[model samples]
Structure formats: structure tokens, C-alpha cells
Target: MAVIPVALAGRSYEVRVGSGLLADVAGQCGKLLRKQRVPIVTDSNVAGLWRDTVATSLEAAGKEPRWLVLDPGEGAKSWRVLERVMDWLLDEEVERGDHILALGGGVIGDLTGFAASIMKRGCGFVQLPTTLLAQVDSSVGGKTAINTSAGKNLVGAFHQPGLVLADLATLDTLPVRETRAGYAEVIKYGILGDRAFFDWCETEGPKVMAGDKAAQDYAVTESVKAKARIVAEDERETTGARALLNLGHTFGHALEAETGFSDRLLHGEGVALGMVLAARYSARRGYISEADGERVVAAIGASGLPISIAALGMDADGRKLANHMLHDKKMDSGTLPFVLLRGVGEAFLDKQVALDDIAHFLDEQLKTA
Candidate 1:
């Protein structure tokens, strides 16, 4: 097991990533939870795979397990769902100091954390991220929210968890597509700022995908370390340091939103395609060579991720896509800030991009398609 600390002063937490860690979850989380009435909040699907083991572990540790099973999937991350969870917690007489145990993927963590943070003003929680996407990214960052009509994560808070337990065993149950989609996040750490790490990913990522334990541990450890360093430097995204983490998020979010944030486009697929587009755009502006853009495409393609707009059957002109971008939450001073790459391992946010110029470039890109 490898433990990486996400340093945020009083609200700091440790992310533990390893295979077979679920059996030890209660022992690991005992520090943050009470001996009695520890609520295990998971969606119905995860409840089947893990609830018993988690309950047994907590019971062995002297904590009685109380469960609040939610319906699985992204649709569960809504105000209506949260209201039901809050009502259940209240009926169970959960206290301010008690914690809600988030035991699923990003959807569960985001929804549960948002509820814990707002219920009775504030409460503690633990994260047991069961998917690779959650393990290497969402579970540790403390960015919690439910989707809104405006956009993804439009209504959320920075409520950090007490701890995160990422059990690799859970990943074994993931469909290959889900595993491939999660790898985009693993690649994000490399693209954001580490050339050497990017090289490592190219070398070892296949084994990680093949279920090699050591490779999985290394990837999760390194990704968590990169995110922790950035979060410690800019915990609330006040500085552009934290903003750098949104490397492909601008275009990705726009695509996800345009798809009505449906299963038709998973966030990671959008991010993979977004990263490729950013590199292509950067190459267009002469920041990076076109050859470098090709490399980005190849990398994402090797991971079985989407690397082009056409892959989504998106024949829409760039103007149509740009309009979707205008609704992006990253807008500042009435202009959207895009995270563009100068090259691999290098990214910078641009706020001065002209919408008409973007439309023109995208229009040109449409012809090549």
C-alpha cells in the first residue's frame, strides 16, 4: 500500500491505494469514524460488491455499520437524491461529528461529500473510491458537487474527506471500457507537468491496464503525488497552479455538456479528446509542433481513448462547439479560459482567445475532418 498525503492544513487527508485494501478499510478509517453508527453510503450496485466486507471490517473494529444505499450512476448525483440521503441520515439520528462513508466511484463520492459538507452545516466523511477514475483523481481533491442544468459541477463545494481508501480489487470488476476511460486521468498527471512521468506512462501503462499490481500501485501513487503537490500549493484554485490541473477540462466539459452530460460521452473520453484538441490547437497557433500533436493523439489512442471530434460522430462546425464552450464554468471577465498545451508536460491557461478566431480555427478543422 502507498499513502499520499493531500496537504490542506486542518482538512488534509491521506489517500491509500492498493490491492485488497477493502478488507482493512475499517481499521484504516477508524481514526476518523466513531465506534458506533458509522454510515456506509454507497449506491446499490457497489453495495453488492462491497457492503458485506466493509460491514464486517467495521464490525471487527467495533464500529456498527449503518448503510444508506443509493441508486447507482451519474443520475444519482442530484439535489433530489441528496435530499433523500439527508432525510435518511436525519432519521437515523446521525450527528454532526458522525461521518458518511462514500463507497463508490466519483458519483458516490461527489454526491456523498456534498451531502456531508452541507448536512447540519458540516460533517466529516471518508472516501472509498471503487473505480480507477475516482482513485487517481476525484476522491482526493475535495471538489464535490452535483450536476446542474448550467453545467457539470456547477453547484459544489471544496469539502475534503477525512481519508480515502482505493481498493484495486474493485477495479477488476470494471468493464475494459471503464478501465480505459479511467486511464485518461492517469495520463493527465503526466501531461500537466512531468515529462519523465509521461515517459514512464508510455512504458508501464499497458501492464497497469493488464492488472499488474505493482504497475497499478505505481500509477496511482505517482498520480496522487502530482495532484497533492499542486493542491498543497493552491488548495482552493486561487492561484493558477491548481487551475493547471484542468488541462483538457475546458473542451472536455463543453463536450460533456453538449452531450447533455449523458453516458454517450464519459468525462474521461471527453478529456482524452479535449487533450488531443488542445494540442492540435496549440500546434495551430505555433506553440507546439504538429508532430507533437500527433504524439498526443497516439498516446490517447493507444489507451483506447477517443482522440478526435469525429470519433464522437460530431460533425458540428467549431462555431457550434464554441457556443457550448461559452457556457463553461471557467469563464472569467466574460471570456472563457482554455487550458492549452505548448507541448507534452506543458500547459498554460489562455484567457485572451477570441471566440471568432476559435470559431475560424475550428471551422478550418472541420474541413480536414
Candidate 2:
């Protein structure tokens, strides 16, 4: 077990990463939230998967909670779902001081935090992320959001969780496809800042994907540590430091829009393919060599992830897919920045990207692929 701390001044909290940390909910989370009643918020799929294990731990601390099990998916992160969840919290008479126990993956955490933030202006919330992607990324960041008609995660809040307990054991219940998808985020950390970590993934990644507990523990802790440092420096992304976290997200978001954010192209899968495309585009721009682009693709492919655009089968040309990126929230002054690679572990922001050039390149990729 590795415990990483997010140094957010008054809102600082510890991310407990281990095999069975979910079962220690009360003892661990109780240290921060000294409330009598805690509300457990989760989606139905995750509740069926892990609610009891976490609930029992909270009950042992003498805190019987008001559980909110919602419909699972990105669709749940919506104004309608947010309204119903807030209604449930209100019906249960949950006070502002009472902590919201968010169990499940990123969707549950995002929705619950968004609800908590708006319920009484601001409230307490705890994170118990079950998926690898959530454990390493979303659960720690305070960027809670509900999607809108314009794009994904367009409506939300910056409500941080009081505590984040990530239990690796629960990952066993994840479908193999999701498991593979989550690894893409793990690779993101390496591609963004650490060359050695990328090398480590190439070697130990197989073991981690094969359910090797040691590798999983180290990867989660290390990735959390890396992201914690970034979030601590710039929690609200005002500075360039925080924006680097979206290494492949620009292209990844476009792919998600093409797929409708469905199970067909999971978030991490889109990211996996997007990172490869970003690398290739970067190479085309003379920012990186063809060799570097191939390295990115090879690493993602070795992890059993989709690294090619053709694999998405969206029935759209690259330019049409590129149009999806025009709506990305990261667009600045009506221009979007691309997170491009200079090498295996070197990614920098390219705000000089021209939309016409992107459309032309994407057109070629569509023609070839």
C-alpha cells in the first residue's frame, strides 16, 4: 500500500492506494470527516459490485449512510441525473456538513462531487475509486463535471474530495476491455513527463496488466504521486503546468465525440489512439522524429490498446473527426492547442496549430486508413 498526499493547503487529503483500502473506509476517512452521518453515493453497477464492502466498513465506524445508487455511464453525469441525485440527498435530509461517500469509478465521483458542490454552495465528499483510471487520475482531481449537449464534461465544478481511497482488489471485477483501457492513462503520465516511467511500462506493464499486484500498486502510487504534484501546483489549471495533464485528451476528446462516448470506444482507448495520432502529427510538424512516433504507437499496441485511427470504425473522415476537436474546452482564443511529443517522454503544448492543416492531414489519414 502506498499513500500519496495532495497538498492543497486547507483542502489537502491523502490518497490511500492498496489492495483492500476500500474495507478501511471508516478508519481512514474518519480521520478527516468527523461527522456522525456520511452519505454513500454510487451508481447501480458499482453498488452491485462494491457498495457492501465499503458500506460495511463505514457502518463499523457507527456511521449508517444514505446510499444513492444511480444509472451508470457518462450519461449519468448530466443535469437531469444531477437534479435527481440532489433530490435524493435532500429527501434523505443530508446536511451540508455531512460527508458524501462517493464509491465506484470516475462517473460516480464526478456526479457526486458536482452534486455536493451545488447542494449547499459547498459540502464535504470522499472518494473511493474502483477503476484504475479513476484511482490514478479523476478521483484525485477536483474537476467534477456533468456533460452537456455541446460536449462532454462541459458543465461541472471544481469540488475536491476530502479523501480518496483506491482499492486495487476491486479491479478484478473489471471487464478485460476496461482494464486495458485504463492502462492508457497510466501511460499518459510517462509520455508527459517521465521517460524512465515509459520504459518501466514497456517492461513491467505486461505484469501489471496480467494482474500482478506489485506492479499495479507501484503504477497507481507513482502515477498518483506525479499527478498530485501537478494538481498541488495548479489545482484550477490557471498555469500551463496543469494543462500538460491533457497529453492526449485533445484528440482523445474528438474520438469520444465521434463514438458518442459509448462502450465501443472507452475513454482510455480513445486516449491510446489519440496519443499515437498526436505523436504522428507532431512528427509531421518536425517537432519529433518518425522513430519517436513509432515508439509511442508500439508501446500502446504492446499493451493491447487500440493505437490506430482505423480501429475506431466511426464511419467518418479525419476532418469530420477533427471538427469534434473544435468544440474542446481547451480551445483558447478560438484556437486549440495540441499536446505533441518531441520524444518518448517529451510532450509540449503546440498552440500554433492551424485548423486547415489539421483537416488536410486528417483527410490524408482517412484516405490511407
Angstrom error at residue 122, model 1: 1.0
The residue pairs in collision within model 1 are: none
The clash numbers for all candidates, in the given order, read: 0, 0
Model 1: lDDT of residue 227: 91
Which stretches of model 2 miss by more than 4 angstroms?
31-33
What does each candidate score in C-alpha RMSD?
1.6, 1.3
Backbone clash pairs for candidate 2 read none
Residues 79-195 of candidate 1: C-alpha lDDT, one tens digit per residue = 798889889888878778887899998999999999888888888888999888899889978889998777788788999888888898998888777787788999988887997
What tens digits encode model 2's per-residue C-alpha lDDT throughout 134-233? 8888998799988887787888888888888889998888887877888998989998889999999989998878888889998899999999999999
lDDT of 1: 0.84
Worst 10 residues of 1 by lDDT: 360-369
Candidate 2, residue 222: how far the Cα is off, in Å: 0.7
**Candidate 1 residue spans exceeding 4 A from truth:** 364-369
Model 1 RMSD to the real structure? 1.6
